[model samples]
Target: MACDREVRRAVSGLSGADAKVYELIESMESAGIVAVPELCEAVKASTITFVGFSCTFGDDGERSIDIGRHGFFERKTRSRTENLLSKLRDLEKDVRFTVFIDDMEFRRVWGWSRSQESLTEECEFQIELAREESQIPGDWDVELWSRVESRIECIPKVCLNTELWHQINSGVACAPINYEMVLKWAAEPAQSRALDEIARMRQTYPRNRNVKLSELRASSVTGLAVYSHAGEVLEFLHPGAIFIHSADHRRDHMLGYRRTKPLPIIHPWR
Candidate 1:
C-alpha cells in the first residue's frame, strides 16, 4: 500500500510518454482481469519505471508498439504482455543495461529521450585529445612555467621567509602551497591576519574559496610562489590561477592538464 501511494505520487508528476506508460500500468493493476505482478512492482519503484519504460517500449518506427493507443491492449496476448513485463523487470537487474537498450529491439524506444550517443562521442573525443597531448614534449609543464613567469613578471617581488619557500629553494622538496599556509607569510601583518580569517571561513563554506582568494589577490602586493612535485595543483587554484614549479627525478616523467566541463547543478527533488 505504501508502494502504491508512492507510485500514485510519481504518476501525478510525470508528463508526455512516461506518464502514458505509467497510466497503462495503473490501468492493468486496477483492472484485476489479469495477474501482472511484475508490471505492478515496476510501477512502485519510480526510478525503475522512469529508466526502464522509455528504454524498453520507446515510441519510434513502424515496429514500435504504441502503448498510447487503445488498440494496443487488444493486439497483445496476455502471454506476450507478461513477457514484456518480465523483460522490463530483468532489465532493472542487468549489469549491461546500456548495451541491452542499444539492441535492435529496444533502440527505437529511446528516440524520445536524450541521445546517449552524443555523450559517448564527447567522452571519446576528450580521451583522444588527452592521448595526443601526452605525446608532446615537456607536455603541460612548459605551458605552466610560461604562465607562472608571465604572472610573476607583472606582480611586485617580495622576499618570502616562510619555511616552505626555504624548502623549495633548497631543493629539499615541499608540499604544495595551500590557501591556509600561503596567507601565514603575507608581508603585512594586518593583511596576513585578514587572509588567515578568510582561509578559516573557506573551511566552513567551500564555495567561498574563489571569493576569498580574489580578496587575497586584490589586497596582496606580492606574487605567491611555491614548489610542487607535480603540476596537478593548478586544478585546485581558484579566482586568480597560479602555476606551481614542479620537478621530478624520473627522466620520463610527463605532466599534463585536462580541462573538464563544469559539473551540472543537481536539484534535490530530481
Candidate 2:
C-alpha cells in the first residue's frame, strides 16, 4: 500500500496498534504543547514518541521539507531554546509541502499546497496584536481587527523565520499573514489602488494566494495580523521571493523610480 511503508516506518519505534494514537499525540505536540503523557495515560499506552521529525539537509541542493514541530522540549532549560526556535518551528508547521523559492530571501518565497481540508474548526489568524488606544490614528482599528477572526474564511499566521533573529530585530524579516478578505474590506472606498495591485500580482504568482501563514518570515515586518491594520497587512506587494513581477517592470516601485507606463489602480479582491 502507498501508505503502508510510511505507516510501518512511523510505528516501527512504538510497535503495535498504538501508531494511530501516537500520530494524534504527535499532532498535538506540533502546536507548542506537549501532552503526550496525558495521551499515553489515557490511552493506556506505555510507549511515547519523543518528538516529531527534524529537517535533514543534504548536498542535493534541490529539495527540502521544513518539519513543523511545536512541542516543548525535555530539558528544564528548554524554555530558552523554545523562544529561540519558536519562529522556525512555526514555519515548519504552518506551511505543508514546502518547496524553497530563493536562497537570497528564502523566507520571502515558498510554494504551498492547499490544506483547506484540514480545517475542522474555523481558525482565523486574528487581527491586531496590540491593545486599543495604543494604536495610532490613521492606523488600523484594533477592535475592528478582532472581529475578523470569527467572520473570515481564512487568516494569516505571521512569524519570523528565526526567533533569535526576531528578538534582536536582525534580517529583512517577514510576517506570514493570512488575512485577505477582511484586509481587502479594510482598504475602504479609497484604497482601491492597493487592492488592485494585490490582484495583479496574485494572478502572476497564483501560488502565493495560498501561502501558509506560518511559512513566511513575518518578523517585525508590519501588518502581520489577519485584519487590515497598517502593520499587520502587506504594505505593498508581498516581498520578492514568491512574489511575481509585473509584466511592466518599468512601471514597478514608487512613482519616480520607474519612469515608464503608469501603474494601474486596483479594487479589492471581489
Question: How close is every model to the real structure, measured as TM-score?
Answer: 0.16, 0.18
lDDT of candidate 1 at residue 55, scale 0 to 100: 17
Estimate, for each residue in 1-270, the C-alpha lDDT of model 1 and write its tens digit.
Answer: 975675466557665544554454444332121112333333344443111111123344423332211111222322334343454445452111100011222222233344545433433343344336442112111122223333433432122224424433343333433323432434345445444543444445455455656554443322221211122233222211211111111111111211121111111110
Q: Report, for all candidates in order, the number of backbone clashes.
A: 1, 17
Q: In order, what is each prediction's RMSD in angstroms?
A: 25.6, 22.5
lDDT of each: 0.30, 0.26
Q: For candidate 1, list the clashing residue pairs, or say none.
A: 58-109
lDDT by residue (130-156, candidate 2, tens digit) is: 112221112111122223323322332
After superposition, the stretches of candidate 2 with alpha carbons farther than 4 Å from their true spots are 1-187, 206-270
Candidate 1 accuracy as TM-score: 0.16
